[model samples]
Target: MASSIRDELLKVLIEHQPHFLSGEEISRRVGCSRAAIWKHIEELRHEGYEIEAKPRNGYRLVYRPDRVAPEELAPHLQTKRFGRHIRYEYSTPSTQTLAHQWAREGAPEGAVVIAEEQVQGKGRMGRTWHSPPQTGVWMSLILRPPISLAEASQLTLLASVGVQQGIKRVTGLPIQIKWPNDLLIHGKKVCGILTELRGEQDQIHYMIIGIGINVNTTSEHWPEELKKIATSLAIESGGHLHRATLIAAILKELEEVYQEYLNSGFRVIKSKWEQAAGMLGKTITARTPQGLITGVAERLNESGALLIRTDQGVIPVYSADIDWKEI
Candidate 1:
């Protein structure tokens, strides 16, 4: 198929780095004819790669695209197997949806599904996640942890910590994790994590952690309603960013944290997450299905639920809408 040909061509380009390969030579290596090789070269060029084709010299890949293709990401990703099996899609309904199907079909742990654009992306509480074309990281990672359902919420915290670390490493931005799983940069929403699980009474089948980061998108790219609250990496850093590099870093960090969580306990990650939490020890209001509770955010329980000290008493919140307030 086209992808197989592209991978072979990419291997040749990487080996030849800054050199050129004749059309005939490339065709022979790829098991394709010269005309077919040229066609694939044109396709790569259309995907934002700068390939130079001379009269008789050959074809040289002057520049690779910044898109999150496996070849582009694999070089930078340092994880053992997190992104080793990545399914990159130029456009899709949602990475989470695709990942769910893969998980159900027994995809291996650390399998990643990423998309450039999501037509039906989702946020928490059935909200629509804004995923513009080629401007953000819309990814879902499949994890099959040997844990119970009661401890599933900890994965959200772990993912938030991973994202915060990845962004900080790449951009050096002072990002903070809001309660549950929202990444904030300069007090605006920059990333969101949605954790979905499938399991039985005492065992877990698999967990799909979907993460969305608004990278390289500007304020104008957002919908009118979200312009005031939603911000992107370009807006925050005042420039464009390489999406592929960021995605690779994120997967690497996720793999590290996930390994630690599996080997150790959630205690270590919980401590780190609380330190990076935005509203810890601060007065906040949480809107729950039962009612509104005003309290000071205290600590995270073992199950990763938010523990708040209210005027009435200490309460453990499993899930709620959070808003920070000035005390």
Candidate 2:
């Protein structure tokens, strides 16, 4: 109820952008009391909205900060289902953890969990992701696909492709995929995707895809170890980007590609993934559970495994950390 009122209040203000709306008029439009309107306006101001208030003129929205709140993301979203139901948080332990709990409680597909800052962000293989406040996108999407577990693993690759397309659409940067789920910009890491699933036997339950992107994070924000390997859109684009705009674009693109995957199949998505994937046909080494394998990078097989042309023979790697020496 409070969220609805806030949304309604923001709607009124946006509708009257660059123009002052009297307190009474805004209260009437939002179906709230004048006192409530003033409180909400003050809250918005605290959230980085610049509202100029005058004794006679009422209030005018002067500036809007690049926040990923629902109000900021709604206008930019073009997807039919994705982001329709968003669980936004100012700070959280991990969006992925919350998404899992939500999925267990029957959260609908296309529902998303977004956080401004993640105190305990997760990465692939139980690693900790570096997530700072207000400078990146930390969100988890819920998906319920009626597919086999083998096919379910393919979604990670699909996510990489979807995120790559979205980043390109928003930033116009030359982004590339590093195998299964990492996005690289100018050979530096900019984004990481972690796709988890829950199921029993042949049946499936739901999947949570956590996506973390460094949008406007500056070089100084990174620790010493990450400074050489990590990067953000602002660093590469030479300007800060609006987090909400990028989030909306990603949700749209991800939804489109997801629908395409369900309708057509993984063939098309695989082709797209390979095209955007970096280091194909290059010499690389992967650390697999069995052991380390060094081989020439080959194309992905039908099952979405990274096939490597080793000296012995061609082997399909299901999961591994690829070391792209050149990249």
Best by lDDT: 2
Candidate 1: clashing pairs of residues = none
**Per-candidate local distance difference test:** 0.88, 0.92
For model 1, the stretches where C-alpha displacement exceeds 4 angstroms are 1-5, 11-40, 53-59, 325-327
Ten contiguous residues minimizing lDDT sum, candidate 1: 66-75
lDDT string for model 2 (123-226, tens) is: 99999999999999999999999799879988999999889999999889999899888999878999999999999888779999999999999989988999
| Residue 163, candidate 2: C-alpha displacement in angstroms | 1.0
The per-residue C-alpha lDDT of model 1 at residue 155 equals 90
| Candidate 1 lDDT tens digits, 132-200 | 998999999999988888888899999999988998889988788899999988778999999999888
lDDT (Cα) of model 1: 0.88
RMSD of 1: 2.8
Quote model 2's TM-score. Answer: 0.93
